[model samples]
Target: MAAAEEEVLGLLVGAVDQGTTSTRFLVFNSKTAELVSHHQIEITQEFPREGWVEQNPKEILLSVYECIEKTCEKLELLNIDRANVKAIGVANQRETTVVWDKITGEPLYNAVVWLDLRTQSTVENLNKRIPRNNNFVKSKTGLPVSTYFSAVKVRWLLDNVKKVQKAVEEDRALFGTIDSWLIWNLTGGTKGGVHCTDVTNASRTMLFNIHSLEWDKELCEFFEIPMKILPNVRSSSEIYGLMKVGALEGVPISGCLGDQSAALVGQMCFQDGQAKNTYGTGCFLLCNTGHKCVFSDHGLLTTVAYKLGRDKPVCYALEGSVAIAGALVSWLKNNLGIINRSHEIEELAKEVGTSYGCYFVPAFSGLYAPYWEPSARGIICGLTQFTNKCHIAYAALEAVCFQTREIWDAMNQDCGIPLNHLQVDGRMTDNKILMQLQADILCIPIIKSSMPEATALGAAMAAGAAEGVGIWNLELDSLSAFTMERFEPQINAEESEIRYSTWKKAVMKSMGWVTTESSESGDSSIFGSLHLGFFIVSSMVMLIGARYISGIP
Candidate 1:
């Protein structure tokens, strides 16, 4: 009782969760790992083309500021001192590239989102540069050449946007993922802002060496990016800098992680083979692979799980992502006119036993992980006269489960250890129907965590683990806020296999349903095909000649 009282003095930690659709701030009592006060605001996405997605960088930062201010006001209303918030951590949407003028702090263009397919032609050109070896940079980067990463988006911005080009030429442009953008502004914007990104965010960029823990200059040249524009890569935990002008101005902005990496920490998947599947705007299934960087032969991404301190050994994980999950529900509500609310899809799906000979493959921005097919587009196959709105809704929900099953299969092949029970946390997990479907499809038990804000909790955990001054220790058992609900497979293995076989066929049909021209060829300053080929060949020749001259290994 005495220890509890002493611990309650000033041990709250604040987390800023800047996600694809919303920005939020939550305060957690480190003594009990329970949420105290929080606020959230929605952010809009601009879609100018069929397959493009963009967000305003200024709006994103403003959302963060408003969330902080509102959450602090709530803390005062509850009679809790805001000074109890020791540190602030940020967990942001990864791979969304943002560029700004360092001198003016103005965004050069709309932030190109992670799922944007505007770089499809750039990816096609990049793959052609390697002559059938699409994974040329995958050996060092542990990622395939896809429009899913930040480098391609950055390359697209430089090639297409005039303002970005001018800023880069003047040496006043700075580039980073959403986390770095948040950190730079939170620390002090244009006035001595620390431009840095954590290991997890850097690993998603395709410009970072997973082994060396630094930016890969050679790959930067291949992508035609300037190295000087990149930020300093840092570990996930430590005092990044002090919050510049918030209720917690002088407080240290200590922890940072990409959303999925933060979810891994929040799920407490500390041991190798412990995996968690986060169901968010998309589905990301990450299996902790421990310290060694285990590159996957099974089409999974090897990425940094987290680096706790400045000198701590990095932990690695195999990540496989699904491009569309919850967003599919939004599409159904707004575009298709099927459901009234996001949660109503589950109620509609429960009306049908199955999809009734239908399958919806939401390759809306194309497939990710296990099958990096950029040419693929959304498809709803096997539709019969028996199918109706309910069946379509059922198929859509099953589509999410089937995609996760594909990733789960790939993770098993890479790790050689099938998870006993898949741990799940995110907004989509609230659908008990989907959770059961996930278990039924994968033939594994599903353990859904009670934490609604697992990603934010993960960031808060990192913030409180900062050096000697922080309150929390980086351990599994220290958190008392976790509770679980177990979901066992209701269907037999044979039934699951038959349904999965149908899903496989639907996936194959979705592939190559769209044009491979990849759009915007004539308007791109993105290098002509012949010019790009010459550039690659010349760069390789220069690299070989330099190596020979230096006699370096």
Candidate 2:
């Protein structure tokens, strides 16, 4: 009977994926690599002002709690013993800032989402005070002085929100990303809740010194953020605390990572030069650089991939990002009313075999990696009378692919090795046409896993490993066999080059859209070398096309 019970109580782990748009709870069976039970709930985004995206911290917590309850109820309905769930791991949207009361754990203001650009003015002001070199902060934290990071968000809150300032003055303020907030509540809330963040999440905050693996006092002082309010940093995989409140109460809360890093682990990108691109609200391309933090000469972030346990060497990555990917599809559906649903964009795009001379750069919040042009704005060029919504939809999808190609070129140059194939996951991978387009443009096979929830699976893997679940062990290579589809390049190199070159022209038009007279902003030149990466590849083709078209040398 005991042995029978042992078989029934097989190794399992739970993952709470708190994303930009939703919260989810997923349970995984480590032995079979199966997602046993899961639940998800959409969270609302509030845009109080232009370029400001916020979410209620209370709502986020409630949504997460509800997801856990519903998921555990599903497990009960399936007659699985809840006790088998040994640990709960978390993967969250990184850089979203939340400042709460240290004693009450009540948020002073709504969470400043990673996408929020409210700190643009703050960033400009801070830049003057910091060392004049643009790479000064990057040398210490591997991130540029930009509004995209948590430190700037924290600074904005400290300056703007009176409640946040009061909390800080009263010594009651607590700062955290979504992962830290969720973990604190999951552990015990205000009552001895462990205040901590994993290394992956910490790396996103410009406050953290990636080399020293601690919150830099200098950065904290520069931002006027009190160190007392910051969460303690820890390894990506470890028993941070026991789940004090939940269906699986007392189960150890063992693992946590920023969503992009989690997807890297979930896709099993464990070696140098191996990479994964998550097509989420934004597209994130991460290439693992093993133990070394390979600073990008190209516009890419240096980040921690994951640290499995305390005292383990941290695995680092070179990250390039697109400010918009799936979000562009959402904008077309919600804002433009071009499609009824995001999935419909794919079919609509197929209605037109090509973009029909249209090229769209969805630089809604400006371009991110490689370009790093915050002043840039969205642009759609080469539109003709023949072009319609179908062409526009196709162009939108192509924008995602083209942006990816640009980043991949940077990763190739930074790592000094061409990636033969790309591993992909997230909401966007469901579109077969887009995946094919990605392969065609990049000229590499795009591999996607059998399970789409790579981010959640990564968190579960970390939890299971910490709990000594043999099946969740990282050493096993069998899990790599779970790849469901591989997209191979279908277009000829010449045609791919032509499409890419046209896209480049559209992006060039998008650059420097915002000038000093329009808004008190300065422009920075886009970084690239004529000898290497995407620029060279696209430039040669464009130059050749120009000469051929004009009948010149």
- For candidate 1, the C-alpha RMSD (Å) to the true structure equals 11.6
- For candidate 2, which ten residues in a row score worst on lDDT? 528-537
TM-score of each: 0.92, 0.91
* Clashing residue pairs, backbone N/CA/C < 3 A, model 2: none
Error of 1 at 477 (Å): 2.7
lDDT string for model 1 (136-204, tens) is: 588888999999999999999998899999999999999999999999998999999999999999999
The best candidate by TM-score is 1
Q: 1-553 in candidate 2: lDDT tens per residue?
A: 2467547545788999999889999998776667899999999998765456899999999999999899888988987778878788899999999999978888999999997766766777787887665556788788888868899898888887899989899899999999999888888988889999999999999999999999898888888888998899999888899988868898988989999999999998999989999999999999999999899999999999999988678999999988889889988777666578889988988877688887888887768899877666777777544556777788888999999999999999988989999999998999999999999999989998898999999998888777343346876666666857999999999999999999998899877655422332222224311111233224423533433212233
TM-score of 2: 0.91
User: Who wins the lDDT comparison?
Assistant: 1
In model 1, the runs with Cα more than 4 Å from the true position are 1-10, 131-136, 476-481, 521-553
RMSD of each: 11.6, 7.3
Name the lDDT value of residue 186 in candidate 2: 86
